[model samples]
Target: MNANQTQINSLSAQSNPTPIVGIIGGGVAGATTALHLSEQGYNVVLVEKNDSLVSGPPICHLHAGGNLYREISDEQCIELLKDSIESVKLYPHTINRRPTVIATPNHDQHDPQSLFPRLLQVQQHYKQLIDLDPSNKVLGEPDDYFKVFTKQQLLALKEQQQPAHPTTIEQWLIPFAQQVDLDTLRYPVVTVQEYGWSVFRLSAQAELSLSLESKCQLQLSSKVTNIEFNPHQAKPWAVSIHSQGQTQQLQVDYLINACGFRSGSLDNLANIKRTRLVEFKAAYVANWDDNQLLWPEVIFHGQRGTPQGMAQLTPYGKHVYQLHGMTEDITLFKNGLVISDNDSQPKLPTPLLNKIDIGWSEEVVAQRTQSAISHIAQYIPSFNSASLGGKPLYGAQQIPGDDVSLRATSVWFGEQNYACIETVKASSCLPAAIKIAQQLKLTGLEPSHRSSAAEESSNKALTESDIEQYAVRLARRRGYPEALALYYGQ
Candidate 1:
């Protein structure tokens, strides 16, 4: 055995041994890192505070196209897409494979007539970037993965749907339809999870595979309250875990903080100050009777009359859709504590605003929600704000928020063996995982082996009964009658 392998065997005292990595958090970044590490032949103790695997509020679905998709490097993008393909396979019911249509009613500066061609220009740019990766040759072609709607085809389709929810094309795009009549304006570039696929369902799928791994010590309903560090010791750091109203410690050669929003909390225990940058945004879920109104996630640009200059409308299912206004300003902080606001709240005097913790409030959410509803109505004319019924169906409260501030794309403090993923969005978790793996010196495993295993796992099919049962459980937890009816009869 090599010197490193010999050392691991000595520390672990196993005939067949590997180093132990204590992964804290059950979110996408944490889960993916733990899974990838285990596949690299490491002993992973996946610890989570929730009783079930996917423990946490259901936030935004897996939006394949977003800030993460646009901002990340091309190499990172390739890894992200590959990881997403593998992950969606485990729980196909969680994702909607339809093409996402990104449109804007108000063009900021670009000529409106040339907008479709401009979109193609950007697509070609991204497509060229993805093509650079050799692994993609075997994985799939970037062009085939997405479809671009041509303007000519779109004009033709619009003529066929004439005078329906009639509107001049100059004023707005076609109304919501299963297939947008203006296909030329639509691009199937993004995908999201089914609205009802809560965190519990997504996490449970990973927990199953994690449980089957012999080397993994999966801990649930557990909390890591402290970290004991001794630089002189062979294993420099040990984690103090609290679970079942008891406490215990685990010595580790390395550690990774994949605790999503709680990452700052863990870093603080290690005496490292990292900040999480977050925005408090709201969503308004409105009812639409047209089951045929299928839309890939729609992102409308230009903020002229809306709450923010831009709005994103996501379809929860066929009959329900959610609308959100972009955050005009943001609050910055470290370790889950807000430090300052980007803009002063006009209504509240500076002194009063400073005295009160004026973060996201009921008033702000309400105003923004109403404004977003009105803005979306410009295109979706049949949309009525009254149909919003009440508060957003999916609230901001569901997302767990914590982070250790990092200025770089992704940062890890190797001295303390802790890293922070400044996730642009959850879909970018895979690149974060790959980054963590490389930093931990766990890249000894061959790339071919890793690819083969991922491929093999992707091919493992899930049964209909499995998906239906998942729906039943989700229905029970969220109390969604549609979920139960979609699976078991109401």
Candidate 2:
């Protein structure tokens, strides 16, 4: 069969005249989206509020893009992740070759004693549900609320049901196990029960930003506040910006909301509040020592059918580590966005964030230190006797929010439809940046080149962005758009 005949080809688009494009947000998603758009031949204006010195890793930056394509079973999500990984430029500390595991606390082995005491009071209620509504039958399936599969069945069914390339934490570990060893899989197996792949702290994104600055016009600290869609004859869109507390506007023919966490708000300003969005306040802990951990039985915990939290490990080589997390409530679903079980309120104002919470509580500090120590303890039982010298290692968190903050990321672009949001890592969001880019490219925009004498035109000023965005934005765009659209034959 011809390549076109065998491969499912969606409608293809290319930019002839090149649209004047402006992207807000400079984090990973924004950066990645902007890069793809630029590569497609667009005159692009990229903006961010942070410069190199103060910024932690890009807000969307987290554990490497775990394969998330199977959510819609889009092979393109898989290919897009491969391309993203292949094209991924990291910073100095990243260890690229280590294969990794999206881990979970082994359910059967868990100390049924329950960590949250609140469940104790509901034990009888749980039994009542189990007896009366086996399936929880609320959604029609008998297995959903009930059956917790055996490890063997989980592994077997997962292999059978999940793609050869599993993508989500559920798939990494569930029939909900979404586990796929990267082509670069490399990690040691301490025991049969505790084998895992390793991934490490990599900083390729920093390189991407530098590359963007070199090839395109990137306005640091230039936060865009408004956008005029199809704005004028000279420029189809005009973007309002806020930088250094000063406000100004720029002209462009196309606009991409690449601003990570701010993406939803920008869309909302553009009048595209399609579905509800929820922010999650998540946390992580690593070894205080920069030394390699001896044996860490990294564990993640979540129930099957429950779109909840996860734990993914990235090897920092030998002794160091990185763990990523999420909660389903913080994510958008057909029913609505999932919020924290602990919070009764709809939202929590997160004022402080960090890459490292050096200010963590003594208990939290000890727990973090002990978890790694316990892992090391298993291998080096005499570790306490050994002279280990080091001050507390540090990882910073963003002050306003971070990759974990669930607020902006949960924007469901009207039911199955999705655009980019910061925290929506559910393999669903991974390839979306590219999908949006392809659309822009097809719409006559060319990636910007500094050397060329680009055409410039004047356009009408835009009012504060608001609704009617549904008609103009992808929020209302149909068909569960995923990575296949992003990497169309990419």
Q: Give the top-scoring candidate (lDDT).
A: 1
User: 60-97, model 1: which lDDT tens digit per residue?
Assistant: 45433222223334444444444454445444554533
**In candidate 1, which residue ranges exceed 4 Å CA deviation?**
1-16, 54-93, 107-155, 159-201, 290-292, 304-308, 327-372, 385-413, 442-468, 479-490
Worst 10 residues of 2 by lDDT: 481-490
lDDT computed for candidate 2: 0.34
List model 2 lDDT by residue over 230-325, tens digit each: 533456556676666666656665556554333446666565543323432322334334332222223343442243334333333223333333
Clashes per candidate (backbone, < 3 Å): 9, 68
Which residue pairs in model 1 clash with each other? Answer: 99-188, 149-184, 150-184, 261-402, 274-404, 274-405, 275-404, 275-405, 303-309
Candidate 2 wrongly placed segments (more than 4 Å) = 1-18, 53-95, 101-215, 230-233, 281-285, 288-313, 323-346, 350-423, 426-430, 446-490
